[model samples]
Target: MDPTLAIPLLGGLSPAAFMRRHWQKKPCLIRQAIPGVKPPLSRTELFALAERDDVETRLMLQRQGAWELRHGPFTRRQIPALNQPGWTLLIQGLDLQVPAAHALLQQFRFVPEARLDDLMISYASDGGGVGAHLDSYDVFLLQVSGRRRWRVGPVKDATLVPDMPVKLLANFEPTEEWVLEPGDMLYLPPRWGHDGVAEGPDCMTCSIGFRTPTPTEMAREVLQRMIDALEAPEKEPHYRDPAQTATATPGLIPEALQTFTQKAVIAALNDSRSLACALGETLTEPKAIVWFEGGEALAPGQGLRLDMRSKMMYDADHVFINGESFRAAGRDARLMRQLADQRALSAQECAGLSPGARELVEEWALSGWMHGV
Candidate 1:
């Protein structure tokens, strides 16, 4: 995808321009963004996905001003009747299960892959809604079918309603309002308050959300990965106090030990490249519930593509796939980065890899992180 090329997906704003003007900055609503777009999955298909144990789903109902929530591997009987008012079924990570959903997600390649998350679908009955709420990540809400009424604004009060199963604003004020039809879309930055209600039965919306890791969360994740990736030294170093003096306070941390601890951590962090490697690996780590079945190795001269569920990324000196990091350079590095960016390699590109790199590709294929194209 060309970042500079304007597209209907962004209301004729190029990806580069959208990133500059709207991304994480404010909201942009576009009518007919997809123009004649249809829901990727039918109502029956979506309900079936919600029945699978591996899929994350939720059911919400608001009846007579009372809100109720339920978790699912829900059956059709468990779902509210079609004519029921103020009820909704939400399915998370649709892109992980459906190829068409994944293809729809790929249209937003303007964002970096590390920040790209997953697509969620919400199917709502008339008057259905999750209530007013704020999210800590960027989102694009696209109307897939029927109609939805949206009220959105910058959040001033961070207060939440008491004792609710879902986080809902105690006081929500709408600065703007719109009724969206099929193919309409709204882009919102993190922490913006929004409430959406279905106008009629069969209201379906697709939410393309991006990952937004807080500083503490990011540090804890990457630091833990770095610690796990540490290699054992040839010889274990022991602390010694050859010039020790007897201390009256045995409970106190010794100054020498404190200095030694700091030095040890500093030494580990001194290897600057390790942090980069750790970050790459962390960014590409697969979802907790995702698992791959092993398969046969790739045949020679075959084209290759990443599995739909695979998470692949790269930094300056390392390529990361399925939470594993590899050092890459020269022609191999170039080819690997291309594979990461394009998610596929042509047969000619595969043929150009060195013997070792080719073997590595086969290993990935066998592990089911990628497949023959």
Candidate 2:
């Protein structure tokens, strides 16, 4: 997309302008972000998806001024009747299951792929809502069908209601409000409090969320990957104390041992591009529950595309896919980075890969991390 072109998706602002003004800064309500936008799946289709074990689904009900929530692999009969009110069904990772939803996500690629996360769809009945809450990640709430009345604001008080299964705000104050209709959208930055209620039956909203990793969580992943990449010691080295000196305090850790442990960790990090390689692998690692089905080998002259479920990324010296990393440079490095950026390679582009790169591509294809275009 042209960075300077005014986009309806960003409320008539250019992508560059929107990113500068709204992204992670404040909220933006765009009317007709997608003119005449319809729900990607019908009620029945969405319900069927919720029934799948692979899908992450949730059901929330508000009855008699009380809240109840449940995880789902629910059947149609398990869901409330269409005539029912005050209930909502939330299906996470809709982009992984619906091609239309996935295509819709491409529009938001202005954000880096590393930060862009999955799309979630919520189906609600009349008077239904998930309750007043805040998220740690930024989100775009798009009304796909019917109408949702939203009350949103920055919350200073982040306390939650006790004993609630969901993290709901104990006290919420709205500074802005709007009733979003089909094709309307609202963008909320991380930690902004918001609540939406279905104005009528058949309310469906698509939530586009970004990944916000905590520093500690990211450090753990990167460190674990770095450890995995490190070579094993040739022999188990025992702690040594050739000097005839004993610790005055038996419970105290020896200063020599502390220094040795620090040196070992630093040495692992000092290994050739180990930190960079680890970051790439960690970033491209797929969810634990995600699995790929093997496919037939690639044929000659076929184009290629990364599987929707696969995560592919590259650093300066290495390419990473589905938690695996490979050293790459020269023409191969350039071609692989192009594939990572575009998420696909044309037949002509494929022709330019080195023999080894081609073999690697075929390997990924056989493993179902990518497919023939």
TM-score, cand. 2: 0.95
Tens-place lDDT per residue, model 1, 1-373, is: 8899999999999999999999999999988999999899999999898899999999999989889999999999999999999999999889999998998998887799999889999999999999999999999999999899999999899899999999999998989999999999999999999999999999999999999999999889889988988987899788998987898999999999999999999988887888998888889898886889996788877999999999988888889998899999999999999999999999999999999999999999999989997
- Candidate 2 per-residue lDDT over residues 1-373, each given as its tens digit: 6788998898899999998999889999999999999899999899999899999999999999789999989999899998799999999888888989988888898888789779999999999999999999989999999999999999999999999889999999999999999999999999999999999899999999998999998889999988776787789687787873766889888788898899887888777688888888888887765789997687899999988888888877888898888999999999999888888999999999989999999999999989997
Task: List the RMSD of every prediction in angstroms.
Answer: 1.1, 1.8
List lDDT for all candidates, in order. Answer: 0.93, 0.91
Q: TM-score for all predictions? A: 0.98, 0.95
lDDT of 1 at 276: 90
Give the poorly placed runs of model 2, Cα more than 4 Å off.
233-239, 246-251, 270-272
